[model samples]
Target chain A: MKQDVVIRTVCRLIVPFIQIFALYVIIHGASGTGGGFQGGVIFASAIILIGIAFGLPDALQRISEKTNTLLSCTGLYIYAGIGILCIIFGGNFLGYSFIPLPLDSAATRGLMAEIVEIGIGITVMAVMTSIFYDIAVKEDM
Target chain B: MIWEFNFALFLFLILCAIAAITVRNLLSAVVILSVYSLIMAVLWAEMNAVDVSFTEAAVGAGITTLLFIATLSRTTRRSED
Candidate 1:
């Protein structure tokens, strides 16, 4: 598939832009038409595009299974860790207003929300990509 | 709301849905399903559910298509019925 010059060139030209757009969606979730789930899926789609265009081996090399597994765990931990932090700060779990950031409560809550969104995006992306990998990988039966 | 455009999209959505179910070829049915997802995304966008629309476009049209194709490669391309 990589030998196909047109597909290779087109994918190369577009993948970076797609990733950037996905990041934009993730970060701009607070103010615009995106959120963790949408952004994460978009990002995973870019990788899936690469996997389709190039091949599974090439894609797995870019993101090894071990790293993907770790990332999935890390993303979930970040979300749960934030909730725990909120509790330790004398608030209910996930109650961002009580987060002791050096800002007004509302502003701090907004920041925490963004952080949680990022964490969710990471987990979603990792899990989606991992599922694709598991399903798409060819077995030597 | 642009009632005319929404009606047109709904029409296309219904057509695609029927085609997807009735098509004998599994691969063609998958393609039709992707089209259905596309129309649904546009409908969501028209209704101002931009987030849902974005999700539909990405997951439904993109990743879901790939997954279907992958599964197709592992199985028969023709439907029994």
Candidate 2:
């Protein structure tokens, strides 16, 4: 479990940047190529990198099982809530423009899409991290 | 898409794939599989499938490799078969 000081230092320095970039990818996904899935994976990778460099116990302490489970569900609700809202507004499911937003049709659609992407990103990040934790954590430990 | 670059990448890709399957060490195979994923990501980007390329790079090369390594920790490093 002993890690080099150099590895720990590098991981500490790089994790924040990785997280910021993940946010950027999620937010910009509406207009660009990267989306919720990619952003979420990137975020999870950052945590995984920390786990690898530090230790599983440290990483789990940072993001506990309860927090992870809550996050995954919260993301799904955000995504489905939007879709159901559209239906309640007399449009088909996920009909973003149907929501009674003050903005114009295209703008409303864009905004809804962004929210959905964020939700997706959150769910993905939590799930992927949890998957890593499950696979990596030792039974005896 | 330059033919020469594509050809070189494909060559490397094939080699990586072969090595990944044939390598006796599970860790080496996992590393080689990661290399294969990276080359495939580049190929996807070259073909204008940037989204797919990004996914390949993130999930395929990044998370999958880490998961494989994590699994390796619980088991033997060498493959008996």
Candidate 3:
């Protein structure tokens, strides 16, 4: 399919804002009405829009399949690592209070919660984009 | 104030849902489905489930619509009777 100039220009102008808002949702989930799942899906929608506007090749250049796979793994590892960290500190799995940050335990737990949310967001965004890419691309003869 | 707005959203949601299922052209059905998703997002927001609303808009309205269009491009536009 041929790319439309208007669509490409509009998407270029809008994508950055969408990404920024997704980040805001992720970071503010602790205090507001958002979380990793919602933020990640929103971020993936922006990337998917880029793919629709520019084409699959352009989107792949921005985030290759290899990079997507790696990021998915890294995100899961980060989540699991936090749980292990809590275990090491003599707390149950995912007990953020055991993290021992410079702040008070409650604040440290909040900080850790945000980190966990980021990990979940990364995995979700990568997986959704990868699934779309795999479905949309045509196989070579 | 809020209840009236919610009632309007719910009405629109039902209309979109019926349109999405009954439309003959595949592309139009997809567009109507997207509208349904958007309306559902608004309803969720009205209920204070911001996270669910955000997910519905991003995934259901946005990505799913794109994927539907992509698939539509690869296949027949008309539904076979």
Output the number of the TM-score-best candidate: 2
Give the Å error, residue A71, model 2.
Answer: 0.4
lDDT of 3 by residue, A66-107 (tens): 999999998899899999999999999999998777899889
Model 3, residue pairs in steric clash: none
TM-score (chain B) for candidate 3 is 0.94
Ranking by TM-score: 2, 1, 3
Give the per-residue lDDT digits (tens) of candidate 2, residues A79-110.
Answer: 99999999999999999989998899999999
Cα deviation of A118 in candidate 3 (Å)? 0.8
Query: Which has the higher TM-score value, candidate number 1 or candidate number 3?
Result: 1
Query: How do the candidates rank by DockQ, highest first?
Result: 2, 1, 3
**Measured by TM-score, how close is model 2 to the native structure?**
0.98
True contacts kept of 3: 0.68
- Per model, the share of native interface contacts recovered reads 0.77, 0.95, 0.68
What lDDT score goes with residue A87 in model 1?
Answer: 95
Distance from true location, Cα of A18 in model 3, Å: 1.4
Which structure is stronger by DockQ: 2 or 3? 2
How many clashing pairs per prediction, in order?
A: 0, 0, 0
The prediction achieving the highest DockQ against the true structure is: 2
Docking model 3 quality class: medium
